[model samples]
Target: MDTSKVSSLEELKDLDMDFINDIGWAKVMWDSLQACLKKSFLNWVDTVLTMSQNEDDVKEWRSTFMEQFEDRCYELVTDIRELHEQVLVNIEKYLNKTQVLCKMLQADMPVIGQHKLGLYQEQFQLKRQMRELEQMVEARTSEVNQLRSKQLELCKNLGREPILIKDHPLPSLNEISDLKKHIEQLEQETFDRLEKFTTVKGELIEIINLLGYTPSTQFELAVITGEESDFKITEENMESLDLFLYNMKKELNNVKEEIYQLRTKIEQLWNMLDVDFVEREEFRKKYVGDSLNTLEALRLELKRCESLKRANIKVFVDRLRQELVEIWKLCHCSESVRYEFRFFDSDTYTEDLLELHEVQLKKWKIYAEENKDIIALLNKHHTLWDKMIELEQNATGADRYNNRGGKLLKEEKERNLLSKQIPKIEANLLDLAERYQLRYGVPFLTFGNTIESYINNLHANRENAKKLKLSARKLQKEATAINPSTSHMTSKRILTDCPSTDPKKYKYTPRKVFTEPKKNPKQLQVPKILLTTLSKSKRLSVERKKRLDKIRRLSRQKETRDSSTYIEFQNDLSNRVDLRSTINVAVDNETVVKENFKSPARQRGTTPKSVGKKSPNLPNKLTAVKSQIKLIF
Candidate 1:
């Protein structure tokens, strides 16, 4: 009975016949018009507002309207009512059809057009749109189903079973494209996994053979070999294969670890016994492989070393103590730090004491390794510092200013270089220490004090020394002014005259000066005339002929050898390709310089220059080649 849903005369059949008769045709028609007009702007038919009561034409107009009511209003209203009902019926039919199709297709209609939105005439166009929507939905649905079937086939091949696909109810393009991409991805993954499986199985078999072990499980056998096995290319099977491979690798690693430890123990014993490099190398070559027999031999050697160690425990203990001291010195340990290990100072040469020393030595070695970078910078700083102190001590010498053999000038340059480097290294150490402390939540220590404290104290002492030197210079100047007679007897020797380490002696280079490997100049192309000697009549000189032949031979050699992967097979046109770069470049680890997100630039003078670094992404040292070349004009 809902007027909006009623589209045909048949829909009214549910009401009793008596009920329809009770409502007369005129009344029914009037009610129907009201129902149809309910979808329009104004629902009721009313008298015109311009009919005046006193005008003579009013009566005439009223009579005219009354006379034409049946033809002009009633007839037209009835016909429109019938036609609109048909339009509704057609629209409802198409809308229902589309809804059913979308529900079955499991896709959504791009839009569900509103009923009664357009005029009666426009209903035809709306109905057409609904039908077109239905057709598109059906076509896409069919395409999706076909794709799903293909996907299932792919899954079976890969031993994968995916859940049934239920595409989103609204979008079309995304689903179709996504499904296609997913199928392609699945195919690629399957191929890659199969290749990986083959490789892993092959490696597993080799490792199993190397370890001389047998596969107890049928799955293990299947993974190692492909015949008559129940292996599937499923995730479960892949995990199983990976696990078995991992266990095999773990076993191999354990064996290797044992071999390495044995070698280390032998090495430690060799050092204790003062064994020569030749004898050690021979031992290494003798027991080269990590086999059971090799392990047994190593065990026997360790036992022999143990007995030898006990026989001369005192000497062995001394060597252990010496090794400990070397690590301690590198770590810049104070004397008190060294004294903590009483076992080294003990007279007792028991195995327990020897083991304690070994443990202590091992502990310090690990600590040194963990802090090796900081240790390296500190070592450089200390070396340069010591050199500076030597230069200062020699500066006070009465006759040190003589530049005989340019020795004084060389020393002065060396001193200046050391002065610059020491502070630079210290600054690096400070920054590295700050990072270490922040990360570890403990102060970086050396010589039994925080490195920060040490650096600060050194800074204070350096300033004080400078002040003292200035005062001494001032006193000397005043004295010279007072006694001009004695001034000529003495020379005003500057820090440039400072004495330094012996120039004749060789020293290890720290700040190595080296450029990038030089590029070879372009090859000189020979003229075509020179290459062939146009006519042998004016015969080419013997030297020219020989050069041409050499060039021809070289060109052929280049063509043949260009793609060779062998290290020694050939090289570029450069004669000294084998030469090494002596430069020690501090490479940025995992360097992928990122663009800094722009914020307001920091105020120029608000932060201390020493406190705030310029940019986090900037290279630490400018002298490093890569940094210099990468950022320079």
Candidate 2:
């Protein structure tokens, strides 16, 4: 057979075994074996024989080699015996363990198949059993190794220690099961960690989104991307995630707070800018939610308002000041009261100062609203009181005598109305102020003084005026020796028209005496208007004789008026200038002016028929001066 022609080991072996029974093949094989033996031992021969003819040398080497071979063979047999014993021990132990597993498996699987299989020789059965056990061990070992690898991976992922068992030759059942249990536990832990990571990651992501932020780090990105296993799950890592979530929530809260404050700022700006209600309401409706986008929108709105405010700081400040003025008016605040605020006078158009003014205006507005009822009453009282004072002042005014078209009569009517309205309003004001003080634990103020205190001052001054008037009457009656019983009545009547004295403004001066100029007994003169109604004249019905006398006097006056024209025209016709205008002007200049020589008490003692009657000669003198002025012009 040609070895090169064989395609496989099985074919080669079959051919070699087929020639085993052939003598010719046996002769060739014997020759080859003899040559292979000679080749193997010839080198130990004395000279390494070149041919089989060297029998004597072969014999000498053969004797020495036989002895050495026997000695080496004995040593090899002894080592082999010991190795065989150790091998038997390992085999028996592995075999017993396998047999036990077989017995345990007997309940599930059975060997009740072919009779020939059971009829196998004892040694062959044991050998097959050992071989099968080896194969099973190999499979088990591979499985345990896989479990160990899985355990390591899981432990690493879980950020914990790995579990392992030593198996030198073959892994045992118990160790393999224990390792699987450890792997299972690690797997469970990994699952739990994954769950926790997923939960925390979701929370972190949700909070971050709510706060309108993005992931900035790889860990955060991993959480957001839902990569749970690649990351090591540990207490510290979870805590870090929790902390990250907490920080996001905190950021969201801060954003919400900022939004609230921004809305507040926008409201104040709206008031200062007088933003239309429609726009304000629309903006409020637009940015009503509490989401991050809402907060952002509100921030933008606030920024816009702030920009507008900065762009028109002066205009805004002026507008705010004007609002303050209106609010002050509502609150019944005094004009000088605005001086108490620095921003009210500040020229610096800064946001800080503007905010100050806004704050003040807001405060006053709240105050006005809170004290609405009281403010209304106070304003009403103030109006009536002012009118009353005005009418009273007009009582003694120099123009009091210029009443044309029933002007003085109208004033008296209004004065009487104010007198009626003022006390009622004042009473309401006082009641309201008392209630205010009771409710708020602070006094109602006017001109910086409490209402109660100011009212008391007025009352006290009125009482003092009454007492002073009574005293003045007693003194006058004692000096004049007037009827004592009637004097009190007359003084009380005089005092009824007198103004009450307030302690805040007190003054006193004596009345001036007016003595009539002595007139010629025989010369008829035009009757002078009495400074006061000196006495009542006797009344008598007009008779025919009196009527005729009055008509004769009127005719004489008519004749005189027909002869004399205007002073300047008469002078032109006569070609003679009169010097009387200059003399009259000098006389008027030398006369005592009421303000200089008279006092308020002088007018109080007089009871005139008409309140505003003028002197007769005074107008004629004024006309002469006017005519003189016309000639000069």
Candidate 3:
């Protein structure tokens, strides 16, 4: 119940006062006002009752307000209380009055004079306004009449006369003859002019086409009107036309030059074809028949040569194979030689042989056995040979050096010792030389080869130094070519507005989380060493290895025992053997022999001393029996 909803009443007190006053009135309107005021007051009372604090006040006031106002506040309500005493008297007095006039409605019974006079005055003013409006309309109508008359006069002056309809009549023959003659003259002149125009149009169209124009469409023709046809040939336009013609002529000359160039290019292409293809064709025709015969002969000759070469190669291969087989047998590693021999049976063996003989003959010509054991032996022999050569050269100067007393003798003794080793060195060098000569058909120390070998070997270090210099130069060049610009990463902090702290407000901002990629450690390949042999007692010593191993085992056992699923009873009783520590049991007869060398000598000579009688309960000593058995093997 809002107080603002009380649209009619000012206040609850005013509403009650109005109600009481209306009840106090004696006139007929008093009842109507009383009813309205009562309704309004009741509405006000209902609204005030809904207010929170004045519920009791609103209820009591609504219930007693009308009665209290009627009884105590207004005279009309007192009259209503006294009306029962006077109601019949007033009704009788009003019924006794008979003053009446015949009237259709009570309001139309007029008795006034000034009001009728005012109506008359109003009608007179309205008539005066109507008269003024009529005079203005008549003046406008007269103006319209005058304007129409002037328009008709203007029409006559401009010669827009009304057409006069007349009865039909035939044209005169003389007029028709004159018109026909005029038409004839017009047609002839038009034909002659059209012929000239057509010729001009054709010329202009040709020029336009030469300028890369097609014929005009309807819209284009309309835009460039037909009257422009005469303007195209005028003296003023002739200079422009001449310029266009000049451009066309220039273009024509340029096209001619292009044509000439194209013709030259074509001629050059033709000449190329004629020189290349025609000569080839002529040669083909001339040689095709003779070449066929020659080819047959050549083919036969090539076949013979191939057969000879194959036979020679086969012989060479057979000799090499035998030598290689012997070498393999000497090496006691025949598997490699057998693999190389298998190549000889293949179709590509000839290619392989050619490659090998061309490039690798020097490398493989030496027998593998000679190569393997000869290097160290040859080095020893070469040292002795060098010493001997030095000594011999010194001996030749020994006589001149006799100024020193015992120097000559000492040198001679040294020379003799070196000379004694010469036979052995010579024997080895000769054997190697012979083997090389037999395998490669080349002498050991040809003069040209020795000189070339000395030159190449002596210059190897120099060449390496030169190559290093070139590589350094190239690296410098690359370093100079590299760009000097370097890229750098920088960070910046920017300041901006931030929300102030308040209990009612919260603000959010993004936080950038930059995570670096985690780098994992690279895995390494563990080295695996395969141990071949060991003594039986070596196995026991390896268990006392690293101190950390015991700690690791104990920790692992503790972890297992602490697990929820582990059972104490389930522990394995046996010790697990480490296979890496297992001893490989093998008996080396050489080792055994070496170990028991004295034993063998003793067995062949004297027997061990023994007691006279042994205990019957004890078993006989088995050492001698085992030793005897081992010796027999």
Candidate 4:
């Protein structure tokens, strides 16, 4: 029944025939089986041959395919070898390029680093040089300041107007050259002045030395010394010349007075000896020839006295003029003084002898009065100067050991008083100089240099203090503007004692709250009865209602106020508009009335009615109408 497993004819022939043999057609079944066997054997032979043919064909096809595959593989191997060579060539080229690049990079690194290092060094050198330049500038600035201070001091000492160094720029080449030329000119002038001054001084000294003798002897001695006077004075020796001249003039005046008295006594003696009280002719006859000789001698003495008076007066005037010129030069008087006194030439006295004498006496009196005033002023100035010098010296001296308490107090008080009085005195001196210059057209008491220096220092200090005050005010304003609140805090801190530095002692610390620990759900025990009896809902509801009522009341009040305000504003706006319109209408109506009634009489009658009825009541009626309208709205 499973016939699919049988394939060969031999297997088909080997099947069992028992079932067919038991049937009536066993021979027929055996014959049929033989026939089927023959047929199957033939079909098997054909199938075998066909299968053999197919196998041969498959083998040939496989051989041909293998041959084609071998050829393809060989060609692929050759192509692959060529590609490998090309790849090797490319790799070598890339390696060469890489080596070149590596060498180039290697060569460039040190050069770049060297350049960087050089730049760094240059920068460092520039910085160093800049620092040196800054230091040099600072030093130069300090030197300039010192020189400026010295210049100011010199100006004060020389009694000249101080140059404002701050106002000028540093001297340029041209300016410096010009200054050098000026300085050279000044030096030459100073040398010439010094020579002149020395000559005058020597002459004055010789005249003074000759004044010790009597007037008759003085003239002889003066003439002798004048010829022998070869003494050379200098700037250094001229310090005491003024004093010497003053003393010499006084001595000369005394000598002249003494000589005058002697001359008077001689005249009286001659008069007593001679009987010259009578007529000249009778006296000559009565006293023989002696009266005639006495008269001639008296006439010669009188002539000599007159000649002597003229010579003395001329010398005195010349000497006085020279002294005044020297004084003016020393004081550096203003241009006006120099111009006025430049030509001091005076005419010689040629009037009556007695009148000439009287004129000389008046001149002497005037000179004496001026000299006394000058001497008094000079004495006062010197006394003040001496007091100041003494105070300064005492201040600088070593402290005393014995009676220290009393002495120290006394010294301190004196120092304070001197400090207070010195400035006032100096101010007075300056005022005196100015007034004298204004009144006399010449400088007077313009002598002290120390006072000028003190005044300058005071002015400088005042300027510095003023600058500091301005700076302080600016700082205060900035501080107030920047942080107004912090200033108060800083002031408070300044007023109080210093805060403790200890970490434990803080100036201000936040307050701490000791909160109770939270209870756990399991630890909390609530009684069932209390939980059941809890009843705060009604109270909370009542509080909420009260809050709502308050909010509603406030809102209602705000609404009412807002409505009232709006109403009032509306009423005011309408009234203002109505007033403006009424004013405008009244102006237009007045114009119309003027135009309609052009005649002077008609215009006057209508203007009064218009002004009274329209102008005055217009604003009030408009306002009332606006109010009524507002009420209706």
Candidate 5:
């Protein structure tokens, strides 16, 4: 048979078993054979129909072939189903293996993730550090700029340009370090120089102050001369300054020595005069003696011998004059004694000076012996006089006004005692003066002038006090006349006018009842014209007419025109009444009865209330009346 067309079972049996046993290849051959068989059967159907005489046998033959084919077509169906299940299982195993591989890879590569995280962290840290470095660089740049500005400012202030190693915009770190070191050195140098300068200047100033000189200009000159253009603190300059300071100190020492010498001279001169510096100066200024060689002249007489002699003479004369004045004061010597010594010139008494001194000393001794008791008496009298004057001053001082009667009485007693004592002392002083005058042929220390002056002052004071008292009484009387109501309650004028002599009568008492007087029938009757006018006037209501009639009745019943209550009621009526209508109604009448119509309840009162319960309206009316009375007055 032909190999390509072999379709029989003998040809299939001759095929290779290996080829037949291959399921994939066998299945592909079976599918191809089935498709070919179907195609051949379809093709043979037409031919068979054309050739067959029985159609039913052909149909039955086709149905039997389809059933056999159907039975044979399921031969590879189980293997195909098994192959599909195996393919699914392989796919599941492959997926699981891939997942496990992925897990293993993930587990093995943990270091990569950790490295990535560390890299990220390092990146962030680097960024932060970079930011910090950038900030530091910016700060450094700003600082450098500021330093440049400061340098420029310093250069401007110095009126110069900055000197630098290089002309760069920013200084290098080395340059900055060098500049800082230089600045520190300059500061230390400046501080040292300033400290030395201050120390030297302080010493110079103290020396100048001690020398009593103004230091500002001198110190300036010492530190800097006007001729020098540039002043710098160098070793040479400082040495020169030290030399100048030394010279100044030497000059100050010389001046101090001279001053000390001058002070010594002054002390010697003061010793010569037996006076202190202050006393000598005071004597020079205020000495009242007629001497060519005054204290000042003696002080100026530089020759020690002449000055000493002159100063001795001046001191001697002063002592003599003081003794004379004392003796005169103590003994109250006659005018002759004062006249004899008044112009006693010490210069003209060269030869008789000792004799004069002896005579004056003897006279002083004798006068002192004689006046010792009198002096004691005078001192006592003077003390008592001073006390009396003090008491008198106290009596007349502002405090006197506040003094109570007891104090005043005590003061008066003291004054009387002083008066008695003063006279006795005066008599004793006069007796002593007479005895001294009679015995010594010279007046004693008689306070006659002082006593006379005091007596005169006392008299004058007494007269003044009497006049003041009289004037005060007159003023009081005038004031009383001016305002009788305000006069003192205890004043004689006020007390004299009091009705009762008994003091109890002045005490306050409750008021008694004040009855209204019976009305005059003639006064109570309203004039025919007023009654007719009131009845006719449309303005007058019945109540007002009745009120007017009531007021008229009250007025008629009043007995006294001076009654304050009646006057007040009248004033109230006048104020409340319509004046124009009232005048029209009673134009002819001398007394116009103007009345205010009140409520029926108020109008019902026929009698006035007690003064305590009187109407408040009464005061206003009374004020009006009083004002009118004042105007009349």
Candidate 6:
């Protein structure tokens, strides 16, 4: 099996063979050791990091600095890209100038025409430009390569899992066998320790005996109160002896009944009789009499009691076992019966284990609590570390920018120093130009004005650049101040603004509507009897009175009241009206309202007569009589 040069998938067959021979079992052991090392490393790292406060105090400006650095990086990249384009253009310009110069030289080389000197000067300038281009290209390429490598490394490590194992060797079969043997030995030792717990039973018995000093028993009393110096008998406990004897007799009877049933079922009556006969005869002679007939009767009763007692004991033991099982379940613990059989031993192991558990429980609890606190610390520390890493990355990026800026300043200073030497060079070139003009009988060339104009432009550009920087800083400060307050309502502003218009206008002149928002109409007014227009308070009072009157009238109409009483109440209500009049009434024309009907005799003739011809006194007497009649009706 060759694993050294695996290029094809089919080579996996050979790799698998090698894996079986070299790496299969070894991998398991190596993985376990790796896991142990990883856990230890992580614990140590966590402990150290958790104890430090350096990572927890990262400044708030870290995020902003990171963003600014990223922006600056982009700016620098764009500048470098533009510089690259400019260098290409400069190179092309230099090449074109050289080509043009060569053509000029070719055209005038035999005669040395006026264009020859101009072309020569242009060629030299182009050559200098080419040198600068080449130098910048090399510098930019080096920087781009470094940047690309850093970016690649950053991307690769973004989500990479750490390799847990640094170095590990394979395990041999012998080592695996040894580990298995050691595990088996440990298990055997555990069993041996468990067997030592039987001593707990003896200790329990000793405790019970220590508490068994009951002076109420006749046997105990006899030992205490006997007349003989060696005899210990107590008169106070004599009655208790009778009760103990009675209970023993009852128990013996129960056991006998159980034995009889067992004998009947297994047909082992002879064996049962043998076990009971002699013991029963002695008990009979000791309790009743020494007579043979009396002993035989007592023996039979004793046999019956023993059988019954055995059956009762078995039943009681079964119930106790069921109750114990229920108790074990309630306590959520396995039954102690397993301990009695499996863990009991006649050694100190059980006691030692109990003591160990008592001590270790406290220690385990303390360690667990400490571990929880450490975990919390680690979590907080990790958060702080993440923030600090981001801050450090931003600070490093800024430092890089500052380095480049310093480099640019140094270059610019060198250029300025060279420009200072340029004046001497220019003076020498002017002297040569004047000699050429004198020799050729022409005017002198002039570049002094161009140099002064260029210097003036440089100063103006520097002043403009400073002003731009100051304005940018001021705008940034204002934007930051407004950002916190403006953030909440930006969405609302967008929604309220017309979609067709620009959003920037909304920041200054907010949209305004001429007409106010329409409100819901007032609730319908309840009817009032007093006036066409009334004060709200008066209207309410009048409406409330009308409502109460209407309610009272409706309620009266719904009831079954006596007709005479109801009629009297209605008359009183009409007579006792409290309405105030706005104007005094004048009786200008009085007319009496009268009800008439035809008599039974008049019905046949279909004729009626009026009683109107009367004296003034009679008229007054008739009016009084009519008033009494009207009132009665």
Best by TM-score: 1
Residue-by-residue lDDT tens digits, candidate 5, 535-603: 211222344435434543543343123123324434544454322211111210111111122223336
Ranking by TM-score: 1, 2, 5, 4, 3, 6
Clash pairs for candidate 2:
none
lDDT of 4 by residue, 157-252 (tens): 333444444312344335434545544544464556456555655766565455433324443333335443332233333444444556566666
Q: By TM-score, how accurate is candidate 5? A: 0.24
Write down the lDDT of every candidate, Cα atoms only: 0.59, 0.57, 0.39, 0.43, 0.48, 0.36
List candidate 5 segments past 4 Å from native: 1-311, 333-337, 344-358, 403-417, 440-633
Best by lDDT: 1
TM-score of each: 0.42, 0.34, 0.13, 0.19, 0.24, 0.12
Q: In candidate 1, which residue ranges exceed 4 Å CA deviation?
A: 1-197, 216-240, 273-283, 291-293, 296-300, 307-312, 393-396, 406-419, 439-442, 449-633
RMSD after CA superposition, every candidate:
35.0, 28.9, 46.3, 55.8, 38.2, 62.1
Measured with C-alpha atoms, the lDDT of residue 322 in candidate 2 is 87
Encode model 2's per-residue lDDT on 1-633: one tens digit a residue.
Answer: 223222222232234645555678777877897897688666655354554547786676666666666555455656766777765666566557666545433312224223454322433455666667667666766786788788777776666777654545445566666777778787787788778778777777667666667788877776778556567786667777777778787887888888888888888788867899999989778876566778888888888988988988898888889888888767767667877775688898898877888789889888888988867776676666556545544443323323245555576678657656755665566567666766887766766656544544443343343333334435543543445335444444444544332212322232221122236666423344222211112212133225334533653354344223235533342331111221121221122122123324445764333334433322222233222111110
In angstroms, how far off is 351's CA in candidate 5? 5.7
Please list the residue runs of candidate 6 whose C-alpha ends up more than 4 Å from where it truly belongs after superposition: 1-120, 159-556, 560-633
| Tens digit per residue, CA lDDT, model 6, 231-324 | 2112222234334444444544544555444434323223323446666456435644222333345467656755654545433333334444
